[model samples]
Target: MFTTGYAANSATLQILMQKEDIAILDMGVHASVHEGCAFTNKKTFPHNNLEALEHILKMSESMYRTKLVIIDGVYSQEGDTSRAKEIYDLVKKYNAYLMIDDAHGVGVLGKTGRGALEDDGLLDKVDFITGTSSKTFGNLGGYVIANKKIASFLKFQSRQHIFSVTAPPSSAGIVKAIDLVDEEPIWKDKLWENINYLKTGLNDLGLDTGITCSAIIPVKIGDQNKMWDIGRILIENGVYTNPIMYPAVARKDARIRMTVTARHEKEHLDKTLNVFDDINKKNAYCEKNNNNYA
Candidate 1:
């Protein structure tokens, strides 16, 4: 295990990438992955753009060095899932390694919370899996899951793991969360229910929710100023949410990132939807005639 999700991501890439090695990262990968690969040759493909990924992989076949592909199982910003199985095939075809940062996927997706790998039956194929202990785990560490050889290798080679120490309390909390994930199936079910309700309500209001298939949802606002103003309005209305802008996303794709949980009741969702609906009608932000915000 590692100190944090950021640490896990950074350390894994650091261990895997050598000088002259190539890292092909999906554009939506967390920044920690980018930072870890800073010393190596790296390129980013558009989110889930398999054609671009293949082109890079095909070119790298002759390099005779490590060519690693990195992607988040569920993109943190857009809440969209990557096609893990298809990517596994591509990485295998080039005799390269594949890594999944299933930070958002664990304890949320899959039957019985086995995460994205199990959800897609990819455990035998992926070389490394890293995730945060904070989400759903209510802790403050991260972990790297791999084969015995790689695990032993990273134990000494990964700088983040060697230098950082995780507190006992954080470790205990993650253990408890893991127990709950095994014991409590209803939590995931309830969370999915909330996700569906929220997405449906936002869609009915004509908000551009993007291509989300998970709990983290984005309501596209498109303009930085408008996104911030709407975010303030949400807070003023006693609804808390995050505003996406600038380098976190393209400037033209600024959005409101919302997350739903098992704890939220139907009324809570309805209240949020009502606020969005009222805002939609009053501001007409989703309409062409009111496209000034875009």
Candidate 2:
């Protein structure tokens, strides 16, 4: 295991894919994936654009010694899942490998929360699967699932893994958390209930929530300045949320990113929705063309 999820991805890719190999990625993958490909030839397709992905795969088919297509099981920003089945099929057709980073999907997707691969019935078929303990397990390590031979190679050859400190005592907590997810399915159910409720409420209020199918919801605010003002207003009113701006998203695509958890009660969500409603009504910030408030 690596110290951080970033290390797991970056270190592994750095070792397995070198100058001769090409790393084809979906644009929405985590920053870690991009950093991992620093030494490798890399190309990126627009997020979820199958046609673009196929074009790249087809073009690079005979050129690269190894081609790896990487995508996120659930995109962190847009909160949508990967088109895993279709992508996997295309990867096979091109004779390339597929890797999925399911950090945000693991404990929140599939029939038993085994993650996006399980949801798509490709759990045992994907070439590689990487995930973190920090998100759903509430711990602090990252792991990669691969064939026995590949797993052994990574454990020894990856520089970061070779020299990194052993996982802390809290590693046990991660195991327990995984068990809890299986033992108590009710939490997943509650999480979905909260997700649907909050998403519907925001949509009804004419807020742009983007195309989110996961707990990570983005309330889209086109203007960066207005987004900052709205973020401040929400915080001052006791509703904390992430104010995402350029670099995280495009300059004009600033948004407030919110994560819905099962622990949150209806009262908490209602309070949040009420605060957003009040802010929009007072400032008219939710309106598409209204930019009067300063």
Candidate 3:
């Protein structure tokens, strides 16, 4: 395991640099992945565009020592899952490896929180799977899973693993979380219920919740300044959430990212929805007022 999920992502690219000359990435991968790829020759494909991936794979097949394709199991902003099985098949056909960074998906996907790899039935096939303890384990660290030789190789050769401060509490916490996940399945059920309730509430008000299939829902707001203004309103009303804007999203696709968890109650969701609905109306009225003044 690495110190942080970011370290895990960056270290994966570093390890690939050992033999892999080129990496193909999904455009919307976490910024840490982009930063990790700083020294590698890389190409980016449009989000989930297999055709674009194929083009790069065909070009790199004869040129690179190792060609690796990387993607997020779940996009942190929009929450859509990757077509992992398709990508796995496509990369295999090109004699390349696929690395899935499932930092957001681990402990949040699958019937048993096996993450997107399990959901896609690719736990054994995919060359590498990386994830974090922060989100689901509620701890601070990251891990990489692969064959014995690769895992051993990274354990010895990985720079991030070498220099980071060691952890005992954090490691214990993650282990405990794993045990809980195995024993208590009810958390997942309640989590999905909260997700659907909140999503329905947002939909009923006509807010543009982007293509989220997981709990990381985003209420799309195109204007960044206006999105910040609404964010302030939510804060005043006691709903804390992230404002997703460029370069996290397209300039025109700024949004308020909302995450639902088993720890949240219906009362908490109703409070959030009430504030959102109130602020939405206020914003609309102010817009009409400004137009009248014009």
Candidate 4:
């Protein structure tokens, strides 16, 4: 069993002794999995480094028979994706299993929006997949899809699944949304169009959106108060966005994160661009003039 959360990692570590453990391929900018079941038993590697992954797999073959590799499909911070196909090939070569936490990829990536594994041609090769419903699925709760054995194990042993209440009534409505994502091509298309448009716009405005290949745009502001001010200005101009400061982001690289959805049209994008332009220009002038407003 593998989990993307710290709790799951901890539980897995406890279940499998550290001495029996193998390596863990963790992203450099990924959320903390510091205190997990595999915390001490882990072999940490660079983010998206398939070469390093292969080396670790080769070294451990004599020591262990079952190898597990964990990664996220779409990273929450940078919004980029894992090289699932490359990793999947490694797993196949070594007779290992691969699990992906596709929290941000469903309905926002892939030809049919199945996620990075599908995008990278490794869907069938992956051993298991976990995705959250709160993001593009536009609902609550999370899901796990796997073979009968893993599914049965998780159903009975995953503490989160066993201890948590079942999916709510509204979750039934979400199946319709998922169906629409499958039946309607326009939603994903519009979502990508908006993503590219905003990404281009942010870059044109001299804002740095770190490695974002998806709809989640993090506009680096470099200061907490300034990031908050940027968010306030966007709101004042009728363009709502979030200010992500320290703890979530690096203290020196605070940002106003914006998500462009299928719901946003050209008018919305144009207005958002205008407001950003105004704020940046005003802020630059204030800094130059030593104005208190800056």
Candidate 5:
């Protein structure tokens, strides 16, 4: 196990992918994935653009010694899932390897919550699967699933795994959390209920929620300044949310991000919707023509 999810990704890639190899990424992957590929030749395809990904794979087929395609199970910002099945098929066609980081998908997706690969029926077929204990596992550590040979290599050779301190004792809670996902399936059901309710409410109020099929929801608020203002208003009224801007998304695609949990009650969601409705009516921020909200 690695201390942080970042280390699991960055260190592993740094060791496995060399200058002679190429790391092809879906543009929406976490920042750690990009950092990991710093020493390797890297190419990125626009998020979930199968045609674009195929083109890159076809072009670089004979150029690199090792070609690995990396994508997220569930994109953190957009909250959408990667086209895992299609990508897996494409990678196989090009004789490339596939890695999926399911940090946001574990315990929140699939029949038994095995994550996106399970949902796509590619869990056993994927070359590598990396995930964090911090998200669904409710602890602090990261792990990689690989064959015995690769696992042994990473355990011994990865600098971060070799030099860094191990995860703390409290990390044992992650095991219990994993157990609960199976024991109490009700929580996952409740989480989905909350997701649908909030997403529908926001859409009904004429707010633009980007294509999200996961727990992370982004309420698109194009203007950065307006997004900050909206974020402030929501927090002031007791609805905490993140105001995402610039580097997180496109400059014109600033948004207010919220994570829906099973613990939330209908009253909490209603209050949130009411606050958003009030904000919309007062500022007309959700309207397309009102660009200048300064």
Candidate 6:
């Protein structure tokens, strides 16, 4: 299967594709995909660039026996999306399988938050779909959603699935989370509302939130030290945020990531912006410093 990874999932992908013999049409921004085949000849393409993916597939027709296209439904760092439908079509044309990691999209998109496949209306077209039980689902476990053939195969051959301990009793929580995503449309609506409000507010502040239309907002802060300092300051002010430092992202492209929730209200958004403004005043945070309070 082709996929993007983050920890547990990445390790599994690494074991699956151990050599350079197989071709992987990979998105440059997928961290796990990059690491999976550290020594393989990966055809790295622009993130969500369907045309680039198509080129890779065309090249693979002569370069390898099997072609795999890996992508993410909703990228974690950028909060941008992959054109799953388009990629699925491209893969079908090339007679290749497409694997998608829908970690950020699950429990957040689609009619019932079934993830990108459902959101893109190409659920049946995808060969494999993987995701975590965290994020909007608010649980702790990983899942691989696929056809019975793939499911049965993994149950027997996927090292991670076979050797790993049984999922915690919290698997029950995942069930509930899925139920919530299905039963409560208001949650998704509220989440989108918060995302729009926060993103707009940050843009109004002249902060470069970076190509994001999702709940994950990345405020580019070039310096790692500054990123950590801002995270501490925000926490002190009662608003916790994530500091993505170098290695995870490119060097000097550190960011204080913000995640908006369906539970957040107008006052919460207002206060978040207020804190950013207050911090900017003391630190002279500006575009020059790459300090975006987004």
Candidate with maximal lDDT: 5
Query: What are the lDDT scores of the predictions, listed in order?
Result: 0.86, 0.91, 0.85, 0.71, 0.91, 0.73
Residues 1-294, model 3: lDDT tens digits: 888888888887887664448889999898878877877788999999999999999988899888889999999888999999899999999999899999888777886888888866898888888888888888889888889998998888887888778766648978888888888988888888999999999887777787898889898878888788888889988999998788888898888899898899999999998988787666662364331100
RMSD (Å) of each candidate, 1 decimal: 1.8, 1.9, 2.9, 4.1, 1.9, 3.3
Count of backbone clashes for each model? 0, 0, 0, 4, 0, 0
Q: On residues 1-294, what C-alpha lDDT tens digit does candidate 5 reach at each position?
A: 899888999988998999999999999999999999999999999999999999999999999999999999999999999999999999999999999999999989999988887867899999999989888776899988899999999999999998889878888898899899999999899999999999999888877787999999999888898899999999999999988998989999999999998899999999999998888888866456443222
Q: Model 5: residues >4 Å from true position, as ranges?
A: 286-294
Report the CA-based lDDT of candidate 1 relative to the real structure: 0.86
Reference-based TM-score, model 5:
0.96
Q: How does each model score on TM-score?
A: 0.94, 0.96, 0.94, 0.83, 0.96, 0.87
RMSD of 5: 1.9
Cα misplacement distance, residue 172 of candidate 2 (Å): 1.2
Residue 11 local lDDT, model 4: 41
**Better lDDT candidate (2, 4):** 2
Model 5 weakest 10-residue run by lDDT: 285-294
Q: Return the candidate ranking by lDDT, descending.
A: 5, 2, 1, 3, 6, 4
Q: Residues 187-270, candidate 1: write the lDDT tens digits.
A: 999999999999998877767788998889999988888788888888888889999888999979999999898899999899
